[model samples]
Structure formats: C-alpha cells, structure tokens
Target: MQEITDETELRELIGEPLPRAWEKERTSLHELDRAWLAASPFCLLATAGADGSCDVSPKGDPAGYTLVLDEGTIAIPERPGNRRVDSLRNILTNPHVGSIHLIPGRGDTLRINGRARLVRDAPFFDDMVVKGHRPVLAIVVEVEQVFHHCSKAFLRSQLWQPETWAPQAVPPRAVLAQTLERPDATLSDLEDYYGPSYADGLYRGQ
Candidate 1:
C-alpha cells in the first residue's frame, strides 16, 4: 500500500479540479438550488466534534422536509431515531456541518456547507409538524457554500436501478443487542421489546 500523507503528494496524484466545478458553487442558494432541495427526500448530515472526531448521519423525510428559511439558511427537523444524539452533541462543540442532499433517480447531488445550531423555537417546531407531531428540536444551518456534485459515481454504480440492489443482510436486532454488555438483558427480551415497537411504525412521527 502507498502511504502518501502530505498535500503536495496528494495534489500531484489528483491533479487540478475541473474548471467547471468552480462554476457550480455558490455562497447562497438560488432558484434552481431551491428547486433541487425541494425535490430531495434525503440527505447525509456531517459533523465533527471539537476533539476532531467526526460523524455522518442520515436524514430523510417527505420531499421538502428540510425547510429553506432563506437564501442563506435552512432548517432540518430532527426526527427521532436511536436517541444517541451524536450529531447534535458534535454540533455543540463544533458548529461547522456539511450536508449532501439527494433526490431519487437524480444523478447530481446538492452539497451545502454551513454553520449549524440546535434550536427549540416553538413556532419553528410547529412549522415542521407532520401528522400532528412536531419535532422537539431542529438544526438550523447558516449556509456558507453550496454546490452541485457531478454524477459519475452514481451513474457508474447504477444506484437508482432496482436490478443493481441487494436485500439487506445484517444480524437481527436482538442478536446484536446480545453482544452489548447488558447483564440484565437477553436476546429474547430484546426482540420482545424492539420487534413490536418497530412493526407498529415507531418511526412514523419523528
């Protein structure tokens, strides 16, 4: 394996960025950018802690789940998940965050880099309510840079093609739970707890 750690060596191997790439970037959102976001149903949220550890979380909702407050700002309703809150915890110590928004069957992705803050404003939460359930918290991002990423990777992988997909093949949740160091829990107990709640659409409101 080659171990090239320095910037000069990496730059030589990667060469210059395409000149057109720079043209796609903007300091704020425009009409087309808004259109892309409005159609996107999912995104990857990236954050880093002050100690430099990083985390990437998947966020999804109905189309336009992430609200565009303005040209330079957007708000993402924090849906309920595992309750680990790693991303939110990271934002507290390091405000900088990045997001990659994706639309089904779209080759290009929209990328936004920004400063984020966790918010609990009631009016904002009300605006994000779905099915009569509002999120307890939301992450507001002050957009700094936005751009469209090219589609070579998505095209080559045929990501949106059903023929290229595979069924999920992971351990059962209960089995994985047994691996954790919980002396009072067992596999059957874990299944009894998670199975029904999951089947009941526990993930619906967030």
Candidate 2:
C-alpha cells in the first residue's frame, strides 16, 4: 500500500469545498429560530476535551424539546440515560460545541457552533419539564454561528427512504450481551423496558 503523508496529497485527495458548501454568510438566531427548533425532533451534539478527544452524542425528544431562549442562546434538556455523561463531561472541560438539528424526511438541517455550559437552575428545569418529568440538568449554548446545512449526507445514505432500509436482525442484542458477559441482561427484557420508558415523553410531549 502506498502511504500519503504530505499536505499536497491530502488536499489533492479531498479537493476544495464547493462554493455553496463553503458558508460565506452568518445568521443570528431570532424569534423565528424557534420555528426550526420546534420542527426538529433530533440533533447531534459534538464536543471535545482540552486534550482534543472528541465525543458525539445523539439527542432527541418530541418536536420543540429544545427551546430558543433568545437570539444569542438556546437550551437543551438532559434526559434519562446511561450514566456515562461523555458529552457533558467534555463540555465542562471544553466549552466549544457544535450541534446539528435534523428532522426526519427533511432535506435541510440547522447547524450551530458555539460554547456551552451546564445549568441546573430550577426555572430552567421547570421550563423543560413535561408530564411531571423534569431534567436534572440542561445545556445552555451561546450561539456564535448558525446556518442551514445541505442534505447530501441524508441523500447519500437514503436515510428517509423506506426502500433502502435494512432488516433489524443483524448482530442480535442477545449476542452483544453475551459477548460482553452481561449476566443481568436479556434482549427481550431490554426491549420491553425500552418501549414504555421511551414512550414516556411521547405520551406527554416531553
């Protein structure tokens, strides 16, 4: 195999960004930004540590789960999940973060790059609460840049096309649990628990 170790080789392989892909405009969020936030049910959050180690986490809720506090800031609640807190820990150590909000079947996505801090204020938590379920913490992001991202990735993956979807039988969860020696696990039990717990927010629109 040939090794590519030079900047020239890297640039030649990747080429230049497309004119439209190269964002030349900056837009600040306003009251209208709430429309986009309200429409998106999912978003990907990217964070990094001081050492440059990075983590990307997927967050979702019913539409409008994220709130636009103002032109300069927005809020996202932390829901119940495994205790790893990888993304949160990264944010505490490194304030910079990037978020991409997406709506299934939608071509355009909202992208935001900014700094984030964890907050546990009662009012903030109360604002995020739904069906009597309140988040333990929320992330407040100070927006530095906001823009609309193209849909190339979704198109390439055919993410919203049902015909391109694969069957859900691969690498069965039981196999995964067994491979990891999870003595207290059962795939069926996990699925049963997941259905109700995940539907918690759906019923009350959390």
Candidate 3:
C-alpha cells in the first residue's frame, strides 16, 4: 500500500472539480427560502464535540416548528424524543452545528451552518407552542451560511415515490416498554397515555 504525502500526489489522486450545475447556481436565502423552512416538518441536525466527535440526529414536528427568525438566524423547538440529547451535548461542548431541513415530496433542502445556543426562556417557548404543546428547551442558531441542497439524493433514492414506500408496521410501543422493563404495560395503555398527552408534554415550554 502506498501513501501520498505530497500535495501534487493528493491532487492527482482526487483530480479537479467536476462540472456541476449547482456550482454555478448557488443562491442565498430569501423570503421564499424562509417560507420553505417554515413549511418543513423535519430536519437533520449535525453537531461536533470539542474532541471532534460528531453526531447527526433527526428532529420533526407537524410543520413550522423551525422558525426563521431572520436571514441570519433560526430557531428549532426541541420536541420529545429518545432523551439521549447527543446533539445538544455536542453543541454545549462545541458551538458549531449544521442542519438540513427537508419537506416530504420536495426536492429542495435547506442546509445551514451555524453556531447554536440552548434557550430556556418562557417567552421563547411560548412563541413555539403549537396545538397546545411547548418545547422545554429550544435551540437558537445564528446562521453563518445557508444554501439549498439539490435533489440528487432524493431522486436517486426515490424517496417520494409512492411505489417505493414501505408499510408502517413498526413494533407496538408496549413491546418496547416491556423490553425496557415496563413488564405490565399494554399497547392500549401506552397509546392512551401518549396520544392524549404527548402533544402537551412535548410543547410544554412553547
């Protein structure tokens, strides 16, 4: 095995940039971009720790949970999830973060690079509440760069193709609860508890 230690060798191995439409088509975020971000119900958050360890987590809600505060700032409400807080921990240790927001059946994705801070104020939470749910903590990001990611990945994966979609047969919540040591729980019990109160619990701070 040979290792290339020189810039000449490295450039030869990787070659020059390929011709890409996106390379010449870069655009800044405008009102339309904000509208798109507001309509997206999901996003992928990427963060890195002080030691360079990285984590990417998915966040979602009905829609508009992520707010475009301005051309250079955005706020994402932290909804209920597994509670691991990998992304939050990384942000606390290292302020840099990246995010990609996606809307189902939509080709354009909003990509943002920013610095993140955890906000726990009541007014911020009050502004985020939807359907009577409020997030306890929100991630406020000061955007450094914002751009649109083209649709190649979605096209390649056929993500929005109806025929390619799979049925939703995820395991019953009770099974997971039981595995986690809640032995006496039932699906109905879990659903009854979650269905009625989950929205409120998740949007508590909002």
Candidate 4:
C-alpha cells in the first residue's frame, strides 16, 4: 500500500465534487440553516490545541439550545461537566472550531466552520440558565462557512433507528466500584453522589 501525501494526488483520486455540493456552502446562516440549528439538540465541537492535538466534545440540550444571535453569529452555552474544559481551553489558544449539528430522524446534518471565543457577559450568561443554574461561560462563533452535509453517513449507520440500537443496562455502583477496585463504595452512595449533579450544576465556577 502506498501513502497519498499531497492534495493534488488525493484530489485526482476523488475527482471534483458535484457542482451543487460545492455551491451549497454559505458564508452566513440561511433560513434552512437556521431551522436546522433550531431543531438540532446535539452537536459535536472540534478544536485543536496549540500543540496541534485535536479533540471533539459533544454538546447537547433541548432543541434550539444553541442560539443564533444573527445571520453571522451563534451563541452556545457551555454546560457543566467534568471541568477539563478541553474545547474551551483550545478555543483560547486557537480560535478555530468546527461543529456538526445533528437532528434525530434527519438524514442530513448541518456543519459550521468558524472562529470561536469564550464569553461571560451578564445578560448573555443569564439567558442560558437552566434549572436556576447558569453556565460559567458561553462560546460565540463568528460564522465563516456553513452547509447542510449529505445524508449517506446517517443512512449507512441507521443512527436514528430504535431497532438498531444496543440494549445494555447501566451496572450498579457497587459493581462499577468493584470493577474499578474501589473497595468501600456502595451503590447507594454512588447514587447519592450523582443524583444532585443532574439538578445542581456539577461545576459552578466563573
């Protein structure tokens, strides 16, 4: 097997894209693009660190949780999590980010490539509050290019089909602790620990 190292060789192998596919990308959000973002409850955010290492993280909430501030700007609230802040930290060093928005039962996805910055403005942060908990920060994206990605991937994977899903139950905390070799933990204690996090923000930092 030989490695393809240059764009010319790769492009020659794949050939030119269809005209409509090439022309579908827009500099700003269009009506349909806005609609897609409004209906999509989940998206994957991709970022690269200064060291060139990359990471992709999942962001999700209710439908339209990601706000379209205008045709050229989007605001995404950062929910509380493990607090590693890999994406947020990457944005600080490198403003470039790519996000793919997905809607259940929809074959086509929305892709956005742009520069991002973290924000903590008062009223903006207040607007993102859920269950009396506001995020410590939000990400503002300057729209550069947006497009409706094709459906072949979703069609092949049948991601939205319930019949294709795996049936697996979450193990009890005692079992989980034992698997991790934590001797003194109980299922009740684990439940008690995780229960409050769902209602109360896990990381409430500014």
Candidate 5:
C-alpha cells in the first residue's frame, strides 16, 4: 500500500470542499449559535499538550451551563471530578482548543476552535453556580473559528435513537471501576460509590 504523505496527493484524492463549506465558518457567534449554546447541555473539550499529545474531556451540566461572555468569547465552568485536570493542564502549554457542543437527540453540533486560558475566578462565577456550588475555575475561550457542523455522523450512527441503544451491552460502571480502576475495592463498595447517591455530590466538593 502506498502511504499518502503530502497534502497534494490527499487533495487530489478527496477533492476540494464546496464553496459554502469554506464560507460557513464564522470568527464569532451568531444569534443561532447563541441559541445552540443555550440549549446544549454537553460538549467535548479537545486540547493538545506541548509535546503534541492530545486529549478530549467531556464537560456537561444543565442546559445553558456555558456562559457566552460576548460574540467572541465564552466561559465554561470547571466541575469537580477525578481532578486529573488533564485538559486544563494542556491549555497551559498549548492554548489552542476545539469544542463541539451537542444537544440531546440532535444530530447536528456547534463547533468552536479557539485559544483558551484558565481563570481562577471571575465575576461571572456567580452566574454559573449550580446546587449552591460555584465553580472555582473556568476555561475562557477566545473565539477563533465557529461553525455549525453537519449531522451526517450522528445520522449514520443513530446516536439519538433510543431503540438503537443497548446500554447493558457493556459492563456496568461499578463493575468496570472495580475490575479496571480499583482492584482492591470490592464490587459492592464500587456499586455504592457509583449508585444514585453519586450524583448528590456533583456540585458540592472541596
């Protein structure tokens, strides 16, 4: 098999994108883009380290959890989790980030590519409180390129189809955690940790 090493041959194989595809990207948010952010409860935050390694972390909250500071800037609150802070650490050395916002049951997504920075505190933190807990830090993104991504991927995967879902096709969370992440912990312990009460601490922590 021949390896395609250069953009010239790749372009020849895939052909150029349509004019509209090139023109659709906006450097800032539009009214519809604001609407999408308001409705999206989840997004994937992508980052690359100085060493070129990449990571994508999932961020989610109630719908409209994200705060759009302006047409060209946005802020995402940091939620308590495992505290790896992998994405935030990457942003320190490589400020570039890519985000894709998704609404439940929607195939289409809103994409943002931009430079990011970590903020320790902001007046807007008060606006982001949930369950009486305010975010201790936030990731602020300066909008570089924004666009509405097409739905072909979701449509092909049937991601939103309830009938197509088989959640139990894989081992449940507690089982996986016990087997893969905490071998010393009993399965019973892991189950209690990940059960219904797990969500109670979502917005309250040190």
Candidate 6:
C-alpha cells in the first residue's frame, strides 16, 4: 500500500472542497449557532498536547449545558467521569481545542475551534448544577472558528434510524468488562455493577 504524503496528492484524490464549505466558517457564533447550542446535549471535545498526543472526550448533559459567554466565547461544564482528564491535561499544555456538538436525530453538527482554559470556580457554576451537583471545574473556550457540518456521513450510517440500531448484537457491557477490564471479577459482580441502574451514579463523584 502507498500513502499520499502531500496535500496536493490528497486533494487530487478527494477533489477540491466546495466553495460553500469555505464560506461557512465564522470567527464567532451566529444566532443560529447559539440556537444549536441551546438544543445540543452532547459534544465531542478534541484536544492535542504540546507533544502532539491527542484525545477526544465525550461531554454530555442537559441541553444548553455549554454556556455562551459572548459571541466569541463559551463554557462547558465538566461532569463527573472516569478521572483520566486527558482532554484537560492536553488543554493545559496546548490551548487549542476542536469540538463537535450533536443533537439526537440530527445529522448536521455544530463545529467549534478555539482556545480553552480550565477554571476551578466561576459565577456560572451555579447555573450548571444538576441533581444537586455542580461541576468543580469548567472549560472556557474563546471561539475562533464555528461552522455547521453537512450530514452526508450521518445519512450514510442511518445513525438516527431506530431500525438500524442493534445494541445487543455484541457482548453486553458487563460481559465485556469482566472479560477485558476486570478479569478477577466474576460476571455476576460485573453485571451488578453495570446493571440497569448504572446511570444512577453518573454525577456521584468518587
């Protein structure tokens, strides 16, 4: 197999991007972008460290979880999760981040690129409280590039179609955890840990 090492070769194969693609980007949020943020409950945050290592973390909360500080700034609440903090560590090293916001049943997504910083406390923390828990930290982004992505990929995957869903087609989460992550744990124990009530502890920080 051969690789195309230059943009010239890559573009020759993929063809030039449509002019509208270039025209769609904005340096700040439009009214539509704010509306999109209001309705989106989830986003994928992409970050790279100073050494160029990368991480993509999924952030989800109720809709409007990402607060718009201004047309060019936004804040995302950090909910409890596996404490890896890969994205946060990367942001400390390299401020740049890219995020894609998504809403269920919607193929198009809102893309945001910006510089980010972590804040331990802010006046807005009170607004982010859910289930009596407020985020200990939040990611504030100075937006640079914002755009709406087209839906070709979602359309091809039929990701929003209920008929194509087959969540049980593979091994259950409990089985997988026991087989790959916790070999010493019994299947029954793993099942009890990840059973139907798994979501009950989402915001309960350990």
Error of 4 at 191 (Å): 6.3
Candidate 6 minimal-lDDT segment of 10 residues: 197-206
Candidate 1 Cα misplacement greater than 4 A, ranges: 172-206
User: Local error of candidate 5 at 156, Å?
Assistant: 0.3
Runs off by more than 4 Å, candidate 4: 169-206
lDDT of 1 at 108: 89
**Model 2 poorest 10 in a row by lDDT:** 197-206
* Residue pairs with backbone atoms closer than 3 Å in model 5 (clashes): none
What residue runs in model 2 are displaced by over 4 Å at the alpha carbon? 1-9, 18-20, 23-27, 30-32, 172-175, 181-206
Clashing pairs in 6: none
lDDT of 5 by residue, 24-135 (tens): 9999999899999999999999999999999999999999998999999999999998888899999999999999999998899999999999999989999999888889
Candidate 2 backbone collisions, by pair:
none
Expressed as tens digits, the lDDT of each residue in 70-107 for candidate 2 is 78888998887766899999998999999999888987
RMSD of 2: 3.4
Tens digits of per-residue lDDT for model 6, 1-206:
89999999999999998899899889999999999999999999999999999999999999999999889999999988889999999999999999999999999999999999999999989999999999999999999999999899999999999999999999999899888889999999888888877889989963
CA error at residue 180 for candidate 1, angstroms: 5.9
TM-score of each: 0.87, 0.83, 0.74, 0.84, 0.97, 0.97
Candidate 6 residues lying further than 4 Å off, grouped into runs, are: none
Please report, in order, the local distance difference test score of every candidate based on alpha carbons: 0.88, 0.82, 0.81, 0.86, 0.95, 0.94
- Per the 3 Å backbone cut-off, how many clashing residue pairs does candidate 3 have? 8
Candidate with more favorable, higher TM-score: 2 or 6: 6
Evaluated against the true structure, the overall lDDT of model 1 is: 0.88
All candidates in order of TM-score, best leading: 6, 5, 1, 4, 2, 3
TM-score of 6: 0.97
